[model samples]
Target: MVQKIVHDWATGKIYPHFQFVFSFKFRDLNTLNCSINLSNLIVVFYPYLRNALDYIWKNPERLLFIFDGLDEFKSKIDFADNCTEQQHKCPDPDVRCKVSDIVYSLIQHKLLPGCSVLNLQPSQFLSGFLMELLEREDSVRSVVYTFPHLTIQEFVAALAQFLTVAPRNIVKLLSEAHSATDGRFEVFLRFVAGLSSPRSARVLEEFLGPFPNETTCRVIDWVKEEIKRQAGNTWSEFGKRSLLNTLHYLFESQNPALAQQTLGSVETLSFRGLGLTPIDCAVLSHVIRWRFGLLHGTVISRIGECQIPRARRSNPASGLVEPLRLLMLPTSFSRDYEFPM
Candidate 1:
């Protein structure tokens, strides 16, 4: 079982980290979590630590192995892809062997003459395996079998540590109704965790660029003044009132369509030969109505017709994609096709 687990991790098919809980006779039941380090044959090995109580309760015969913690060594053990610090170093150049080498070494002889080495890469922190395993019903139950489980406050603290941000900043954000609400923040973390699409990570990358400084703020002010000037000239008295109403709706109501429309009117622009899926529509709408433009609706409508496939619905909500950021459609289509209204 141990060899199989190690082999899977080495091949990038499974996560390397494992938490073992043992139930036994005489000795105290315990749980241990960490990576393996077989090189050091020091005094037969020692048990490191435990995560949850139930880990020990489930496996009784293997309880001796629980206390024999050779597998849970904490030294800097480097795998093939990335070098770990302290004891386990990266494989030597001469040790450039296939992944099967480690598997064979561990499982084949049951005893070895010298050090048998293999390259192991650090797993992606938020891999699919972790998400499924951690979120599973059994897993959560196993975790809480020991205690009452962490409170929301504890969860928030853990998140802050993982994010490397001050708890105060996160607390303030979560305490309000603005972009930092609990759901929004969880969504944000899930995105950063890079579990599903890497696209969300890229969106986060864009938002995380150097924040606005004095020069940027000045530019914002200049842009606002220019927009105000344009608004005064292009809008009639009723149009101005309606525009203000649109702005209010965007800020107040959660209606994405209204927000999109308001943003679209702020600019006149069109991307050509683009095939917009429903996802693209939501993103495009968000960018234009509130953030960017003034009634380029005719242009948008024309492009929408030309680019989107006939069978697809025009409604953006049909797509599973969220409008966290704008997504541009592919730009490789024929240029001769004009936008249709």
Candidate 2:
């Protein structure tokens, strides 16, 4: 259907006109209390179609109705119910009925049966931009080269957030990113934090004009507060993950003073059940070096016993000191966890 429409548009056979109907407009239609017939709907919401009502009715097959942001639609659409049965359907274009009934009849194909109806959610609407990106030759080549790695994707997402989001709301954005426990935003959060640094911001400014200083400051400040909060609760899994995340953010910023202010009072660090990745250990090693030059009295229990050696092998200069106390638990008891050095 979409291909045919595009072909028609290209060949100048049909000039498509867009009629926008937001979710709020549907609510308004329901509350108007006046006759909610097709002619009135055309006159009120789709004014351009008012004069072409007869033409539209005669050639309903040529019409395409796009219902976007279906996720935000408040009213229930019961597909199984016979509420819009043959007798209740609005057969005539000018027939009056409840707004919901009209919608039901349209969707159930009792009205304008030959017309195309497209339903889309917010995410699906945004995916059109990604489709454009995928259509580009350079972007396609980049995708092929980076097959499984999501680093570029994460970086682009971070960049998009910075470019679009306001400085005042940056704190809230970071907070929401930090609160995600599934680790889906882990690398993305790190990119966001890395972009907060003056050096990184300056690099970005060369291509995208002046980056906002207020947003960077807000992100930095939010990281500090999170570190402070996570430092006090390092025993729990959530605290361990959050503290590790903040440390990565801190390391990304390359701010020694921020690191010292946040981690100065901490004596002992615990990373028991958390499975430390090489990247996690590298960040941990950097943060530890930044804190004490050489961290002593470190305790790594269970899974860290295996991960630390691998992290050390990957980066010998990571300076992952031998654990003073290594308690190895059985594999059955192991759980994924994270911690700061």
Candidate 3:
């Protein structure tokens, strides 16, 4: 079981982080909130987390694992049952064990040999697991550090609003109004969803990026509607800039259709074989710029250089080839195509 878990994490198939493993709620009959607290620790890990496995792997001996605030370690441990020094650091032999039992095994020089660990606390913390492990090993020890003060009052005051007030759910409202063309509202929803700001979008990527396809499509649709509703001339532009940012988000979604869907009237500005004509070259260039005028440079570059197959919806349906960043599609039927760098 341990080996299997390690293999999966090494291959990037599972969430591989030390905190993730530590946060696991082992089977315990003592507490009502044991399981709930473990899952809630996940909420704590959600905001910011560091994957320390790689660094630990590289220098097991030199690395010192500092686990601050031991009081936060909610689950109980069986301090006596140290796995008696076994091999394998990542998952050990089994995970069907308590947090303390696992930490005990690691402390016994069973997992990640030569690695040292130190525990810090606000006061004389008494976890049998830590005390037993430290006594069991001469090198291991614990220390209590004192701090001046942490202003939790101000933090709580700031956090109270978000905890009390509900979010403005525009998606449901827009869904009702734009039922028929709801799919076309991704731009507007993206703007609103990100709080219509670049900084907000970056933060939201973690929370919202991994949403399922159905939810993603719906949010994209609602955003599209909002963008269209706000569209106007770019002289004192408010909408155009937001529209551009949202369009960038759409392409980043890796959903090919959303990229194509944004061009309402000019889904296919077909330039097949027509680029040879002077008038066609001028007109096609203009059309490309006008339709995809708001997208980022990479999107524009890929779209411009990529060889569109004779069909958008094609046979054998190899699906859309990944946009080759520097590959140019041949204007003619010849496969050997080249464009200036």
lDDT of every predicted structure (CA atoms): 0.30, 0.60, 0.37
Angstrom error at residue 180, model 1 = 31
Give the poorly placed runs of model 1, Cα more than 4 Å off: 1-266, 292-341
lDDT of 2: 0.60
For candidate 3, the lDDT comes to 0.37
Q: Give me candidate 1's TM-score against the actual structure.
A: 0.23
Error of 2 at 174 (Å): 1.2
How high a TM-score does candidate 2 get? 0.46
| Tens digits of lDDT, candidate 1, 1-341 | 33443456457654323333221111111221222233221112323433332343243222212111222333222334332222222132123233223223322222222222222222122211222233212242122112133343333332232233222343233224222323334333322222112332244324222222332233223223333443444234333332332223233223344344333354332334333345444433543444432333322433433333212123356655222222233443333222121
What tens-digit string does per-residue lDDT give for candidate 2 at 1-341? 23443455456654333222212234344456655776677678667867878866776655555454455566666666554353355766688876656666666667766554555443231222222232212231121212134676787677666665355677787788789888788888888889888788786665454666677778788888988888778777778778878889999988777888888887656666676666776676667656653444443323533333112112358756443221233343246433333
lDDT per residue (tens digit) for residues 1-341 in model 3: 23333345457654322222332222222233322221233234433433444443554555334444454666543334443332223244223344454455455555556655544433322221222222222244422222222332222222221222232443565455334343444433333343333343445334323223343444566555543543332233233334333444443333344434555443222222223333323322332333433233423332344432221121346756433222345544323332211
The TM-score values for the models, in the order shown, are 0.23, 0.46, 0.26
What C-alpha lDDT, on a 0 to 100 scale, does residue 331 get in candidate 2? 47
Could you tell which candidate, 1 or 3, scores higher by TM-score?
A: 3
